[model samples]
Target: MLSYIYALAGQFQLTHERLSDMPAAPPVLLSDRQTEVLKWAAAGKSRGVTADIMNISEAAVDDHFRRIFKKLNCNDKVVAVLRAMSSGIIHL
Candidate 1:
């Protein structure tokens, strides 16, 4: 699951970089899991479905989202998604 998440995130990150109209981040690094969570969130997947797709619990998804918010310095899911997009960590 982790590997899938990581690869998926990297793929979306590259896609987001090529697509979004937002400013990119200054190359800040994130853990593979964090990037994955951000990618799903940015792509508008709810916590439960993301959890299912990742084969994790919904609570685990929420927990990851909290961690993602902290790592990205974002206040909420929307901001986190925007940040993820801007940072090329998720596609629009």
Candidate 2:
């Protein structure tokens, strides 16, 4: 039983190391609409305001943000904007 436990622990360590070494997915290019939305967001516009200015629904703005986050691998608006800018996906 002790040997089995040690073997299991070794296996877990190996799996963890392999997973940690795995490279992240490559960045995806943003669509024109997505870049537009990110530009508005970077300008400090709220989603509602962006939606109003773009003549799009608030839900559509949210959807755009969601896709942006996914493409940028960000979990928050600030990070998403930063990533978008740094990646040349959007400009000020």
Candidate 3:
């Protein structure tokens, strides 16, 4: 019974290691402009400022955030930025 237990434990360990070795799911896809918007947002920039810096209109920035929210599956910019950072979609 002890040997059987050990064998089961060994198999479990190998399975656990194999699972860990598996690649993570691909990150959510975002457009280049969306990424830029999220990057600016991560840096604590407001949409207005990001628009000014990116030389786009505020409405354009708003549109980007709307799409970003959909892509990242988040409603708020802060959550979207956090998800993007965590998912390797964007860096700080």
TM-score of 3: 0.70
Candidate 3 — which residues are off by over 4 angstroms? 1-26
Specify the highest-TM-score model's number: 3
Which of the two, 1 or 2, has more lDDT?
Answer: 2
- Model 1: lDDT of residue 66: 79
Which lDDT tens digits does candidate 3 get at residues 13-85? 4456447966654569999999999999878798799999999999999999999888766577666776676
Q: Indicate the worst ten consecutive residues by lDDT in candidate 1.
A: 2-11
Judging by lDDT, tell me the better candidate of 1 and 3.
3
**TM-score preference between candidates 1 and 3, better one:** 3
User: RMSD (Cα, Å) of candidate 3?
Assistant: 13.8
**Alpha-carbon local distance difference test for all models:** 0.72, 0.76, 0.78
Candidate 2: regions farther than 4 A off: 1-25
* TM-score against truth, every candidate: 0.62, 0.69, 0.70
Whole-structure CA lDDT of model 1: 0.72
